[model samples]
Target: MRISRLVILGGFLTALLPVALLAVGYTLKTRALMLDTTLEQNELFSKEAALYIDKVLVDHRNVLQFTAQALGADALDPAQASPVLARLRAAFPLFDRILVAPPSGVTAFAVPELADNGQRVAGANISDRAYFQTVLRTNTAYIDPDVLLGRTSGAPVTIIAAPVPGPNGGVSAVLVGTIDLDSLTQLIGRLHLGASGHAVAVTREGVTVAHPNARLVQQRFNFSGTPVWQYLRGADQGRIASYVDEENTTRFAAFATVPATGWKLWLSQQHADVDAEFYQLLASSSLWPLGALVVGILLSVLLARMIARPIETLHATARDIAAGDLDRRAPEEGPQELVSLAVAINAMAQTLQALVVKERGVRAQIESAVTEYGRFAERVADGDFSAQVMVDNAGDLERLGHALNAMSRSLGLLVSEIKLATAQLGSATAEILAATSQQAAATTEEAAAVRQMAASVHELRQAGESVSRRTQAVLDMAQKTEVVAETGLHSVEETIRSAEQGRQRLETLAERVMGFSERTHEIAEINAAVAELAEKSNLLAVNAGIEAAKAGEAGRGFAVVATEVKELAEQSKAATAQVRRIIADIQRSAQAAVIAAEQYAKASDAGVSTSRQSGTSISTLAARVTEASQAARQNLVAAEQQQAGIEQIALAVDNIEASSAQTVSATAQVEQSARSLHDLAQTLDDIIGRVSVRPGAERRVS
Candidate 1:
């Protein structure tokens, strides 16, 4: 709460801020750099180790491939491949054994032959081995991940095989070489990564190929479940990672992969070991800022005391002066700025003492002058401007006495002028009131006229709308009539076509009737000829009968013949008479049919003529109706236009009515204002009459 504490606190903060910031920034940057360097060094070591391993594996693969190519088809034969296989085994000591297997996966030849279960290694059937099958199937080189123990040496070994091509471009045999994994383990173990650091190599399946612990390699230990494998799995070339190991110790690991064999390598170190130096540097760096803070606090307290002491002395002096002790003064002895403030405070106290003495003298003069001015103000308030003040001293009171006299004279003159102006104002306002009353009456009449006109225009618009509606109905009816007329014309056309077709058919019927008449006549002629033949035969038979009588019994036979012929003649004559009658009936019916057909043709012709005439009349009626509809439509359009014009007129009239109404209202307000002005003029005359002015300052009353 005190100035001394605030000063001390402010100074301390200013001095310590930079030191604290510098310490923190340096600690963070240093830690980051050291962490990066540690990780980078571990990663670099893994890469170098991986490259070394890759080179060893590649060299072995190349040698095996070269030997396989050199042996070619001969690799399938034990006698032919023995010498070359011996040289391959002697050159690469890392290989425990070198052998050649035929397509059947049986070993045909092997260097340094060893017996397996009392059978020579040469005759061993390895067809079932996955590595042998892989070589045979892929027809390329392969490195097996399964570790095998040497039969004789009892050491970890793995197989790397290359296919030997035959003369037919097929694999004649597989050239397999066994690698001593102990050698790989020793090579990785040589890396000098700290006390807790070690490197190991594993296959893609996490099967250990080389490890510092030889027992793990011999047992084919799998690291797939460990945190180290989590970082190594599927890692392409190299990376840095950290995790808690199986031993419960957090470790930083760098992973690298051998490109030649797909084997993963990692160099692991304890977390504490990697960051040991970084922590030590951070601890030592914090000490300097802590000591700087302590020194800042001490210096701030001493400096704050020097500044606060002078200000505290000036505070006490100012308090005494405020309490009416004008003699008190601040000391002018500390810093230059403090001394200046002290002198200003002391000068203010002296000025206060001088103003107090002068204030007493001025107070008495103001009181004496106020008493004299009061009497004059009282007379003015009572409507009497007849008296004035007369002070002795020629100061503010003397000026006040002269001002009162002037105001009294001026009030007399002003009252006289107001009386004269009030009378004229009353007359002018009366005239204005009369004129405003007349204008209000005229505006009221105009408003009523405009309203009536607007009603008339609105009625006209309604009538026009009615006409438009009726015209639309007429047009609809006309459209229906036109459709009917068109249908009637089409019917007339069909009737005329039917009439023409009927006439042609009637003519054909008449020709058929004539042909029937001619046929009947031919039948009559044939019957006549038949009748004549019958009559002649009857005559012949009768003559024959006469001659029969002359010849007795022979004549009887002739008479029988004649009688039979006579009977045939009578039947034939009867048939002839029936044929003539039927012919005559047919002729009469044909003539009747011909006459009926001619009558029907004439009737159809008349019916068709009547239909055409009716259609013509209907068409003419439709045209007249359409014309009437168009005229009605034109009238409707004209009426609609007139309606719109009337509507506009109605709107204009409405607006005029409103304007006239507003004019009347404004006129009434003006009339009221004029009356108020007249009444005010009379009130002014009375008010001015109450005040007494000097003699001879009078005006005529209205």
Candidate 2:
């Protein structure tokens, strides 16, 4: 069993045992006391009965004394005696008979019914009894012994006797008063004390005089022979005791002696009847302690249970707590101390539960933060800088996430810058390569132009040799023709004067044509410079395209602008080719015209030689012929003017050569500008690369 069960049981036993013992002790004591009380009540009732019988005897003695004195009086005559007997009988009804006896042997006895016959010599022998004899001899009143006797009426009687005085004063008549014993017997029968309790009257000699039982009255009682008689004689005047009678019935008896008549009055009661009442009292008292003991046991059990229940609950709760169930709680109830304990225990349980939950939550957060940080670190290690970590709940973990995100963004920007720089570098290199190719093409064209100039000089030498051969043959023929023409010289003199005017007009026309050729070469040089500038702009546009690609999405519009520039460069190249072709056609035409002018000059020289020979042959006619020869010289002069015009055209060709040299210098400057643009693009590429962006999988340049 548990400790609580033991305690409760112990408490119940402790409470019940003493109360049970007390009840038993009380029951025994009460029964004994009730028995004592009943015995005392029976003794008191017997004493009261004895006292009543004694009072009746004293009243009879007083009546007898008065009658005796009346009999002794001198005034007592026979006639007076008869009246006196009448009065004495009327006054003392307890008396059976009354008589007056004189010394003359006359008797005067009064009977209540026989009053008519007065004094008579009657043989009522009470005059010879001891009490009657004593009265006559002693001259005193006396009571007679109980005797059997016949009065003057022949009735037996027990009587009282007194001596009446004589006229001489010795003895008069013997007075005898006879008592009725039957009447006393009837009075004793009427006395009642209690149930089974009765009164008895006995003479001083132990003779039964009067008793409630009719058979016992007027009987002789042997005082020395019977137990009750012996007890009454030895016992005190008023004494009480319990005894078993001859019939074997237990009785409580009391005895009293009447002083006036020397009679004993005894009262007796049954002991069993008196003790019945005490038993009832004992029964009633017994129930009280029994009820008290039962109630005490019940209260002890209730109190014990109340204290133990909470302790048991606390024990169970403790066990559960030990087993790791923090949620269990004990109920708060019962006594002050118990309730307080329960409250404290429940508080402890709740606190433990809260602590467990808080610990779990903290642990979960720590693990989550560790896992998230690990993933972020993994991404960073792989060079995938685009991943970002998000922070929540604003703690150390959140701060760490923010830091990682910032690093990622910085790395992304760095990688972008590096790609831009690489692209710019590639564009610059392409520009430099294009510029070097154009320079090589220009050098090859210059070499071909120099070879063409050598071929033109060789052709001019061959034309000079053909002119010398023709001059010799013409000289011989001119001598023969000179003789024949001498006569016609005078008529030709008028024509020579007209030819000199034409020579001056032709010189003016040649100067104007040479000025137009110089102007055209200057215009060709301006157009060539413009073409080179357009080509340089196209190279700049290509560099811009590289920069736009490097800038990625941010430079898309700039790339479009670069494309338009490239188209403009192509249009400028076409216009430059057209200008170069026009310059070449002009050079070819000018060379052809120079060749025709040389041929015409040779023919005119031949004509002038022939005419001069003819003019030398005639003298008087020579004057008139001089006039004719002058006309011929005028025509030769006009031809010489045309040759001067051709010489002016060759000067214009030399000026065109000077303009071409200037155009070549301007093209070289344009090529230099394109190379500078390429170098600037390369610088931009370096700057963009140096500025870090987010790193990609590799550090490769585009």
Candidate 3:
């Protein structure tokens, strides 16, 4: 931009400053108003929510009072009170159970004969319960500090007890109804504020009674330590407060006390929720000013350009002159000052043009001399020492050409000398390069051989270690084998003796079984004899009975005795047959036992023979293992010796490698020096030979 445009823009900005300030001031004022508006809105919400919760509590309390009034004097009668309690429990769905407790601390009647937790409570004592004690003393409604959860299907519930007044104006009995906190939590949970914000209710003692999170309700969160709670502790009216919550989030909260239960209701919102409107307002207001500023800047630039138009013409002319158009002049036009400036610039241009004309002639002469000198120099630069300069008519230029001619002649002679030196230097460098290359090749081969030797040494060391480990392992095995072999020999001898003893025992067992077999055969023969005797007694009895019949009464007594003896004889004969069969089975078993005993004796003899062979084989193996172990130990000793020799050889090779490294380093330095000398000689020859001395003539020194 032009300077004039910048000045105009600056003035425009200065004029618009107050408007920008007013916009900023308005934004700040709106922000404050927004904050106050948010706080009032939060406070209003808190009051409304508190009233809602209070109304529910009042309605439930009214039901309890009405029930207590309806109970009359029959509240003490178990039979009458039971029906009344059941009716109340049915009528109020929120109550988990209802109970009528007398001043004596005994609950004579209950709705379902069970407490909220499913414990029998009709005859249970309610004197120790918090709700019962509170209602008994206060003669008013008692809200249970903690809601105990039911064991069966019901949600957690608190006892709301209202005392029944007696005719004497003293409390007679308390009517307790379990209020399910689920309804209260639903009430609070349904109250959603701005996105994710919500409300919570804590008891008079700061224990959380209702919350969105069941865990928090179960936790009975104590709100006394929180800033919002502390603020509400000192005031009955709902008010908004700013604080960080337990989750470390900045929040704007309003709190109010539940007048019926003394519980506090906190309605909270995140800070961002409250600031949303303020930022939206600021954004909407800020766009207009930004657009206006852009328009103002554009207008300023156009106006400034119109005012500075004449000055731009002179600027163009000055640029043309600087670009080598010295004849270009600014037109003397536009405003008076701009016209004067153009006139002055034109005058300067006219004088500069004349001077430029004179300078052109001088420049031409100088350029001609410089051109001829450059031609001679170019010839010399290309390694041609035959070109010379033509003297010019200009006085100083002619002298310069003479000097160039003399210098070219001198340089030609010098180039001849330098060329010969460079040729010798090149030959020396070639020889040095070849010698260094051959040495490097030899060094490389030696390094490779040394690396191989080192690798072999490493392998030998590893092999020696492996051999030592194996030999040690073999030696241990051989010693163990020898011990085992000696143990086996003793074991084999014991085995042989035991086998002989077992064979003798088996032979004795065979003889006993053979004797048992013979005994069974003899028993069979004895039973056969008894069978014949009994048959004879039976025949005698039968004949005696026939005689009795012939002799009438006299023979009858004798026949009877004979009949008895016959019967006993018959039984004895039958027993004898059974004993014979048993004897036959015993004989078969005895024969089988004898066969098994004989087989056992034969097996014992074979076992003894096998044990003897195993001992002999073990003894041979022990001897062979000892010999091998000895050989391995000798080889191990030799390998260790070889490893030491190889290590010494490796050390000698390392020395040779170090010497080769030093030789290579020295050769590299010599090669580099030779190369530098060769390059320097070539450069000097080129410098001298390339200068113009004379054309079509060659000069050589050697």
- Root-mean-square deviation (CA) per prediction: 15.4, 72.9, 11.8
TM-score-better candidate, 2 vs 3:
3
Q: Which runs in model 2 stand beyond 4 Å of their true positions? A: 1-52, 73-83, 100-108, 113-122, 137-139, 143-158, 186-191, 221-224, 279-702
Residue 296's lDDT within candidate 2 is: 70
lDDT of 2 by residue, 1-702 (tens): 876677767776776778767766865675556445544553465455556645554455446656656656632355666677767777767677666555544454444435323434343334455666677777765554353434444433456766665567776566667766666666666656456766666666766666565554434443335467766775645444566654567666667665545666676767555556556665676677667767777877787677777788888888898788887888888788978988998898889888998999899878877776787777766667777765655667667777778898887777676676668667766776597658756854774574455445445434444443344334334434455455456534433333333333433444444555566588689888988898899899999999999999999999999999999898998998898788777756655554444444444344444544544444445455455555555544554554455445445544555455565666666666667767767776765545433534321111
- Which of the two candidates, 1 or 2, achieves a greater lDDT against the reference? 1
Better candidate number, 2 or 3, judged by lDDT: 3
Cα TM-score of candidate 1: 0.54
Q: Against the true structure, what is each candidate's TM-score?
A: 0.54, 0.37, 0.49
lDDT of 3: 0.76
Query: Residues 291-346, candidate 3, lDDT per residue (tens digit)?
Result: 77777777777777766777777888899988888878788878788888888888
Candidate 2 weakest ten by summed lDDT: 693-702
Each prediction's total of clashing residue pairs, residues at least 3 apart in sequence or on different chains, is 1, 26, 6
Best-to-worst order by TM-score is 1, 3, 2
* Candidate 1, 99-142: lDDT as tens digits: 88788866776876773334457777778778889988898888
Task: Assess each prediction's global lDDT (C-alpha) against the native.
Answer: 0.81, 0.62, 0.76
How many backbone clashes can be found in candidate 3?
6
